[model samples]
Target: MTICTRFLNQSRLWKWSVLTVAVVGFPWGVGTSQAGFIGGEGTDNPSRQLKALFAEYWDDELRAGPLEATFLGDHRYDDRLADLSDAAHEARVKRDRDHRHALEKIAPETLSADERIDREVLRFTLDDRIEGERFRDRLIPITQQDGIHLQFAQSVNFHPSATVGDLENYVRRLHAFPRVVDQTIALMRQGMAEKRMPPRITMAKVVPQLRDLAPKNPEESPLWGIVAKLKDWSEADRDHATVAVRQAIADKVSPAYAKLAAFVETDYLPACRESVGLWDSPEGDVHYAFRARSFTTTTLSPEQIHEVGLTEMARIREAMEAIRKKVGFTGDLKAFFQKLKDDPKLKNQSEAEILGRYRAIFEAIDAKLPDLFGHLPRTDYGIRPIEAYRAKAAAAGYYYPAPEDGSRPGYFYVNTSDPTSRTTYTMQALAYHEGVPGHHLQFSLAMEVPGRPAFRKFGYVPAFSEGWGLYSEGLPREVGLYTDPYAEFGQLEYSAWRAGRLVVDTGLHQKRWSRDQAIAYLEENTAVPRIEIVSEVDRYIAWPGQALAYKIGELKIREIRAQAERRLGTKFDIRAFHDRLLSLGSVPLSVLERFMEQNQQTEAEPQR
Candidate 1:
């Protein structure tokens, strides 16, 4: 699942909130002595010192980012929203710097191997965030894909409203909307003065979303969903909560959205830059270089990545040509792509058909999961249509991991916004990537990994997570799932799409390729629908260096697996290999490679 810059920024805070429930111990026999050290002085014991520091940082993070806390199922701060003000941004930067300083002072040599890994992960996270401060990301928070407005509109889905107090907390957050909106506008205004605005075209997309979110009638507001679901409460209590929620929506939330829309259309949109690439902005080259390194968790320059993309695309094209010939398709590979896109029979008949097929696909995939994975997540997942308001700007699909408390199941949000545009063959590959054996499986297992700090459990490294997702699409083929040539072609199409991202993203950013040029390249190369290709290009424009993570990550993962297979000969177990990878949680590519090298001789025993 691709993440926007706003979501990425918030994820740093979200990653640090500790789960409220006790996670089941990992079956691999990793000792949990360090996990028990939540706080206290541990100057003499570096392991204890590092764990205590992690605990402290976690607490600070939750306090600083209450919304993120709520998302993590830690309800202590459910009544509050995050501080989006400049002071909050400054404080966060200082806190990250301080944490890094504290981390560096700890003696890594004195800690256990696990604690050392934690120290390095935390250090890397801190340095990345600190380095990002110079780019002034906080100023340009609004984007076509994500922003404060869109997050608030979807609050009812993620925010708990099971009880009266939860309902009241939801209402309080509604009341708090205006303040956050104003804070966002202030930041955007500052962005304008500093010349750090988003592209005018992307900002144009935000205007309609804000207008759609801001309704004159309170009952019509998106936040009204919570009030509508208060059936368990006493009638009088429910009535009170309903009234309060409606009033908050009418008086606070709607106006706030309307105000934001006005500001964007009248003030900010006009000031937005015409150029799309990061290279066009001040210090953009340096910023793009940093993002490329940070997102891929590698030091490879954009030129090297672009060439890797070109090579991979060529290989994938050959594979696609073989598939086209296998299917007895006429004309060139591009013609085959066009036929795939233009075929009405390839499209879903209705949204229900689209969702129902995904459910069936996952059910079949779940039964076969044990053939490849020894350890599976206890947390379950479900499929849902992407909410209409933001679906146009969103990706094909994305996974939202269940809160560690298991208050809700993880979700794979499919974009059924235009059902006919949803092709039939792509369903299996998309399902595998976004749902089981992809994000839901990887993320749920990560959250359950025992004795890890909150950051390690919940933090996302795009290369690892997205790489795993891309790798998952192809994993099913080995299990003989994609039997139909069209289905296998679908998988290849998605692979080509990700491979295309490596080229298109760098092309737009580093090579200074025009947005149209990137779009044309993707159109000619991949079988992805035209609408999605356009959306993806704009996404790359809005979030630089992120698109490079998928193929780069997949290639690294595949490389490691190939090495393992070669070393272990017939003894190599795919299930154990998968378990070990998931057990590490989401980490840097470098960290993952180092772990694999050190543990090459010591394999994780397969779970019975």
Candidate 2:
């Protein structure tokens, strides 16, 4: 039964009823003891059998294409590419299923704490995949928001550089673009028959992007941007690269664009569904609700989540209003929002200037981290512009995890495609959220946590991961940072953005709100530009229930932190609390609460 069902039925159950439940115990489970399980040496060392498994996984994953490797910081696979074929998808599913099957045979009681957590993450992930596959998601193909169109733009924007090798890699990958686009088209076609077509409005946006990138003269294409930067290369090498890239564009890339555009504009557009949310699909509502529970790692119902979103929206608006009043704006909050949107000073001169601004924000915030965070990420992080192809449809910013072996640094990709849309007031919180205190810090720290399984260290529960990022944003103020009022307003803006996400995400999915309605809701409530709101609404439409995670996760973390502070009082060391939180990496709220309770007990005990 669902937790809600259990809650409703609790009144009828005998108060003292007892039932056996499976629980991890002793050598079979990793508990407080750090002991290694299954014929292992030290507690930190996995059993030799598990070590072999780890090595095998590393090798297999490293062999994934160059883009995947580069994203993961594996330089070895830089020349290769992701296989988007049906066969590749099948292989991926089989691999996950096989791993889950193999893991089920190993008794959980025989694993250490780290190993136990790793095992659970893998099982949960595999279970989700198996369940997800049963739904036959292919019927829902081609959201205007995806496809290789945006990816090509992204590469041109970010990959062009001074180094010959860097330029060559960009050109090499551009040459291979046609095959990748074909793969994407095949996947979309499979989705079309399944009734999974993207909304017509989104597919309309795809055509313009194709036109912009598919230049009649190959020299004018974004690939030519790399050619422009090849000054240092030897004439022969440069000629070779230029020829290879031009041919790829003319023969492979351009034709691929023509095919996809024709398919989207002519074929798929007619069959696209009119419904706004997945709730319209077969058992769509049930799937979305399940996803909500999984993402938040809680038992919140759609109604409850909707209500919480409403509450947060009101609270954040009031805060923004106060900022407006402090700044002595004679007009109302809405007026101020409009003024900020139109102000010419808000726009950056160019994309490079935007990166420099973000770098400054990172440096400014780094000076303040020591005041609040007891633990910090060891991996270095750098800022990069989002590739042009994806930039138009991508989030304002995102963080990529650093390579495990430390060869490549973690990257924070900022989308500066629309300079007018990027505002300085928001940069402080954006950097913190995507870089330092946000994703990279939490993710990189999790990767470095000793005595944890590789999976647990790298695994994500969206509620846990995104919740931490949202939670990290407000933490700076609590630690006596964000002294600048505008910066604090930026934080409030960030909070408002997440709060808006909850309302809009649920509003669209459960309430069947229209795309325009969702976009209008964001504009009325926040200072974000109309274009961004449109794109964001489309994103939520494409990927239902994901945006809800930010606010829901943040609220839970904040709730727990307040509970911990109140209970421990003077004994609560902020640093120690942070340590406990980070030490466990990403865990469900239930596990986090348990950890807090354990810490409280430790605090209550007298020191030796």
RMSD for each model, in Å, please? 3.8, 9.3
Question: Where is model 1 more than 4 Å wrong at Cα?
Answer: 3-43, 603-608
* Number of the top-ranking candidate, with lDDT as the measure: 1
- In angstroms, the error of model 1 at 320 is 0.2
Candidate models: Cα lDDT each: 0.81, 0.66
Runs in model 2 deviating more than 4 A are 1-66, 75-80, 138-180, 216-238, 330-332, 342-353, 405-408, 450-457
> In model 2, which range of ten residues has the least summed lDDT?
1-10
Clashes of each: 0, 20
Summing lDDT over every window of 10 consecutive residues in candidate 1, give the lowest-scoring window. 21-30
Q: Write the per-residue lDDT of candidate 2 for residues 133-160, one digit (tens) a residue.
A: 7665544433445434654543443343
